[model samples]
Target: MKNRIRDLRTAKGMTQEDLAEIIGVSRQTINAIEKEKFDPSLPTAFKMAQLFELPIEQIFLFEI
Candidate 1:
């Protein structure tokens, strides 16, 4: 999967730590998500979409 997390966070003037706190994850988890090195769980994905005020489809894209 791919995501617009880094771009959106920068656009919102948010740091990885800030977003992680809001979403109840660690900074490393957020980093992994941003880098596409890890896939978020369904609940975490839902939290991300809610936090960003975007649809999951808009934030996340499947590569295959």
Candidate 2:
């Protein structure tokens, strides 16, 4: 899985800490997600989609 989390967060002027605070995760978790070392849970993905006003598919890309 790949994600636009860093791009989106930077675009919104949010630090990993900020995003993590809003999404109820650790900053390291956000970093991991951005680095593609971790895939967020469905609920976390939904929160990100809602926060970014984008669809889940737009934020996270799953390659077949």
TM-score of each: 0.95, 0.98
RMSD of each: 0.6, 0.5
Candidate 2's residue-wise lDDT over 1-64, tens digit each?
9899999999999999999999999999999999999999999999999999999999999997
Q: Residue by residue across 1-64, what tens digits does model 1's lDDT show?
A: 9999999999999999999999999999999999999999999999989988999989999888
- Who wins the lDDT comparison? 2
Model 2 spans with C-alpha error above 4 angstroms: none
Error of 1 at 54 (Å): 0.7
Question: Would you list the clashing residue pairs of candidate 2?
Answer: none
What residue pairs clash in candidate 1, if any at all?
none
In terms of TM-score, the best-performing candidate is: 2
- Candidate 1 clash total? 0
Q: Give the distance in Å from residue 5's predicted Cα in candidate 2 to where it truly belongs.
A: 0.4
Error of 1 at 1 (Å): 0.6
- For model 2, state the Cα shift of residue 21 in Å: 0.2
